[model samples]
Target chain A: MKVIVNGEPRELPDGASVADAVASVTTAGSGVAAAVNDEVVRRSAWEATPLRDADRLEVLTAVQGG
Target chain B: MERSASGVEHEPQEDMDSLVIAGEEVGSRLIMGTGGAPSMQVLREALTASGTELTTVAMRRVDPSARGSVLDVLNECGIRVLPNTAGCFTAGEAVLTAKLAREALGTNWVKLEVIADEHTLLPDPIELVDAAEQLVDDGFVVLPYTNDDPVLARRLEQIGCAAVMPLGSPIGSGLGIRNPHNIELIVERAGVPVILDAGVGTASDAALAMELGCDAVLLATAVTRARHPARMAAAMRHAVEGGRLARLAGRIPKRRYAQASSPFDGIATSQ
Candidate 1:
């Protein structure tokens, strides 16, 4: 299924978890965090977290400022 | 030891109480950051423009491949460091990051950021309050980056935060005070210093923050990411000063009818 990650759509393998989806797309770097469909997935749960159809995933980093 | 803008000996102002945080008096109210600038030179120039004595920096693993050296730049500037736990979620995580920052920076001052939502990057008040209490108990001067909730502000203040930082809007959005009324409420109620942190797009936004009684402003993107970072930084510094002066000067009350600054009745009785 196609899942939106950071405003871009990427093809997700069947039964892809949040962790799997995140690793598939962006370069793993410092200060990264994620929200799945407006609900924040705690860092620990990112691995077990599963993606639903049309789930809007937003990945952010501590770029600068407050 | 106080130094004037021209590097002359200067005495600290008696009437203006230096911002007392963890028993240390910080001279400048403006707190800058060391991220998002195109280059280190630009970052240094922007910091100079802002006239900020305290600069916020994050603790990241030293990448051997990385080009910019935040330490060398910041050390040269001679500014006090304010480290942040920017991406921490839970109290435990934030506390850990704070400890690491203290160890790395050798300062007890921490900008505790417990983000609940990743999309908006808003602070989780529940987790934040919990972290603040723990950090304060652990003897770390906690400066929580939080939302513009007055009750939450009071709660955080009661929990012993050095300062309360309410967002003008989402981080890096540059929306410029989406909720000024709530910010004013936070300002009116907060016992600790209220710093309008994040989402300031322009100099006017910083000025507006000061006019609303905020003690300071913590911004990075508005300056670092601007087309002319140094110029924007200088503008923001002036805006902050002008707004502070205006607030001290006491603004005229708003009225339905125009009340002219010069007397409308008769000033030299124009023919």
Candidate 2:
């Protein structure tokens, strides 16, 4: 499956869920949140949330920020 | 909802003790985040409310053909960029990221953050020091994101960091000042400005940090993710200003009873 994250396209495993997609890209124990098609997907729903072929997934994390 | 000066209503401005880094004077002490907003419109509005002069943003994994929108929104708002080394764990990686950010953003200023413990989002002090030294040598105005360690802060300042940002609490914990005494130590001893960055949850947290003599506060989740992002932003702006004013005013020594600002004892007794 293909997903767009922060405007960059990446290929994910077939039938990959949002949770799976997030885990694939992020480091272990990193604090991250996601928005799919511009709607925020709470952490609880990441597993159940399905992705489309060209879904825009915005993944953000709590890094050292201002 | 309303502000006053000398017992009279007045328009509000975020604290007067602005931070001067690289000769840039920022009006608001509360630096905000650009993430977690329900919409970009709300995010922009919240930034306006917070009266923030410095805002955080990240670099994108480029596809060359695709256009990123976050940067444009930030530029449109006219807030100064404090591009962070968000994902870099090693000193070399951080330096490279800082270089990339400078080239991409057209600013020599970089927020140097080297994360060691991914779970807690705690900084790697050893790596941060190394990165700061290298970046400063490279002519980047390094603002190191670090733990609340006075000795470490002094070390960074010695290495030419523009400012030392010590965490009030863990990033995004919404926990205000887990070790304020330590933060106070950093503030009192450091020659450069100390900005209380990360884990600030509310306006009072920002205020308390200022009252503790911190030069500024940088937070994102508290306002960007709030139930009322814009209102929280506004509150933080005022809170920073109030805290700064109170700090400048200075306080009377602690006493058994409240000391009156008015000359009650002299006036009534004399009359």
Best by TM-score: 1
DockQ-based class of model 1: incorrect
lDDT of candidate 1 over B1-41, digit per residue (tens) = 57778985543553484566656777876788776888889
Clashing residue pairs in candidate 2 are B15-B241, B50-B233
Judge the docking of candidate 2 as incorrect, acceptable, medium or high: incorrect
Cα displacement (Å) at residue B29, model 1:
1.7
The list of candidate 2 runs beyond 4 A from truth reads A1-66, B1-17, B63-68, B256-271
Q: RMSD, each candidate, Å?
A: 10.0, 11.0
DockQ of 2: 0.08
lDDT of 1 by residue, A16-43 (tens): 8988876765554534456677555665
Give per-residue CA lDDT, model 2, range A1-66, as digits (tens): 789976779898777888887776664342345667756576778899888889988665322234
Clashing pairs in 1: none
